[model samples]
Target chain A: MRDAFHDELNALNDRLMQMTNLVRSAISRATTALLDADLQLAESVISQDAEVNRLYAEIETSIYELMATQQPVAVDLRTAITALRMGADLERMGDLAEHVAKIARMRHPVSAIPVEVRDTIVEMGQIAERLVTKTGSCIATRDVDLAKELEDDDDAMDRLHRRLFRVLLSKDWPHGIEPAVDITLIGRYYERYADHAVRVARDVVYLVTGSREFDDSAS
Target chain B: MRDAFHDELNALNDRLMQMTNLVRSAISRATTALLDADLQLAESVISQDAEVNRLYAEIETSIYELMATQQPVAVDLRTAITALRMGADLERMGDLAEHVAKIARMRHPVSAIPVEVRDTIVEMGQIAERLVTKTGSCIATRDVDLAKELEDDDDAMDRLHRRLFRVLLSKDWPHGIEPAVDITLIGRYYERYADHAVRVARDVVYLVTGSREFDDSAS
Candidate 1:
């Protein structure tokens, strides 16, 4: 029974890592689609999110079954619970990627990102990809140090998010209200995507340490 | 043992209801702050979010203790898991409300909402309040029917969210990029809040029936 429960936990970890990979690819493609107005890439991101959701649904079912059958306690219990949360955050990361793709699709034949903000969007996308990559590593390795590093990536994403806004709110922002609205929502999507990645990493930390990061700080 | 587990579940439900009320008030005051440019009200919303967070942290601790010590199975298990998920959604709702309040605070003495889009925001805020109110009741009563009704409120919120974008995109929109950006984000915050409420409702349904709504649809 113990070995079987451990196997189930390993399977849950593998599923969560798969989710991270999919979300990473989704955001990477979403950024390209936005920058180049590649409707095909955008469409692919939007459509392929179903696979991410399918994985998430599978993870949910498996976790429920594992808890129902195994009744894991202590560290194993934390593993199951945090896996559920990590799956949720990764699932949301997928949605955020799709949201970015939808914006690209919406403005097909014309790039949604203004030329001035192009570099920032590129950087945000890279940060998002980087964060998710590290998140996957943390999940797979249970490396607490790597999980802590995710906060730095998150901070960098926030900096770029603010920069995107500054460009929008600049006096010479020539794109007017339409692009402003698009950029505002797009920037928010990337920032939120980064946030979910960080959250998943935090769960990894919690699962490994058996202590929530915030609680550690408070104590 | 079963009676004690159920007692803990009941306490979790009561905490969730309390969270719902806190978030509902937060959104209500956030809307009023944005519309009236009421600095005091926005400040209150911003500051009071800590209380919501406190309650959520308490609930998390309780749920973790419940799961760890009891290893509840079946319906008791679902209730504990869903309580954690619902607590998370409600905590996010609190953050969304605080986002609105921060916008209000930023634009103090000058309304962040333009006169043209004011009605839509008012309606959005009202729907948010109503959805969360139903969410509270759904958690309290585990009423699947009441939980289903939240989808209608969510639809109403979606309609208003689009209406907000329409007014912003219209050719005659007098506001420039700043207010437009604010409105776009505020609209999204409210829309996402409603989505979270619907999710909580869905969780309520799942806890009651031991079946996911989407699973039922798929079958």
Candidate 2:
């Protein structure tokens, strides 16, 4: 029974890893769709979100089932609970990616991001991709250090997000209200994507340390 | 032992109710702060969010403890898990309200919503308040019907959100990028707040029905 419980836990971890990969690909593809105005890629990313949601639901149900049957205590209990929270964060990250893709698809032939701020958006996307990749590793290996490092990536994403805001607020910004709204919302999507990644990492920290300190800081 | 478990469950429900009330007030105050440019109210809302977070943590810890010790099954188990998810959604709703308040504080001495879109924002805020109020009742009574009605409020919010965009994109948009961005984000904050309420209501639906259909629809 103990071995079976451990196997279920391992399966849960694998499912979470799969979710992280799906979210990573969604954000990456969504960014490409946004920058290149590729409706096909955008649609693909949007539709693929169902898969991420499915994985999230499956992992969440499994966690609950594990808890109900195994009645894990101490670290094992913490692991199951934290896995549920991390699944939620990852699912939200995927939703953010889908939001970006929807914006890209809505704009169709025209890029959602104006050319002047495109580079910053690209940089934010890169940071988000890197953060999720590291977060996936952190979850799989329970690497507290790697989880801690995601904060730095999140900081980089924040700086890029601020840069996008500065450009929009600049007197020289000529894109007017439509593109400005698009850029602001799109920037927010990327910013929130990184935030969720950081949140997942923080959940990993909590699972390891059993401390609410990291979770508190993320808020 | 069963009585003790019931007492604990009641305490969990009370904490959730308290959280709902706190989040409701936060959104109300945040909306006022944004519309009136009241920095004091915005600061009050922002600072009060800590209480909401504390309640969230307390409720979450209690739920986990209940599950671990009680080993609740069937309806009881579903209730416990659903409470956890509902607490999370309510906490996020509080955070969204805080985000709105922060925007209000950041834009102090100036209204965030331009005059053209001010009424629409006001309407959105009202819809959010109503939905949350119903959501609170739904949580307390397990009123699946009331929970289902939140979707209508969400639809109303979506329409208002779309209206804000139309105003921003209109040729008559007098305000430049700065105010436009502010209005856009503020609209989103309210929209997301309502979405979280609907999510909480949906959790209640799932707890009662043991079905994932509504949950899938919301996502």
**Per-residue alpha-carbon lDDT of model 2 for B1-219, expressed as tens digits?**
778988998888898899999999999999999999999999999999999888988988888788777777777877887888889889989999999999999988988877899899899989989999999998899998888888889999999999999999999888888989888888888888998999899988888888868765453
How do the residues B33-113 of candidate 1 rate in per-residue lDDT, one tens digit apiece?
A: 999999999999999999888998899889889999999988888889889999999999999999999999999999998
Clashing pairs in 1: none
Task: Check candidate 2 and list the clashing pairs.
Answer: none
Task: Please compute DockQ, using alpha carbons, for every candidate against the native two-chain complex.
Answer: 0.61, 0.64
Model 1, span A83-202: residue lDDT tens:
898898999899999999999999999999989899999999999999999999998898999999988898899899899999999999998889999999999999999888888888
**What is the lDDT, from 0 to 100, of the residue A97 in candidate 1?**
97
Worst 10 residues of 2 chain B by lDDT: B210-219
DockQ of 2: 0.64
Q: Which stretches of candidate 2 lie over 4 Å from their true place?
A: A217-219, B217-219
Candidate 1 reaches a DockQ of 0.61
Q: Give the TM-score of candidate 1.
A: 0.97
- CA RMSD (A), model 2: 1.3
Chain A TM-score (model 1): 0.97
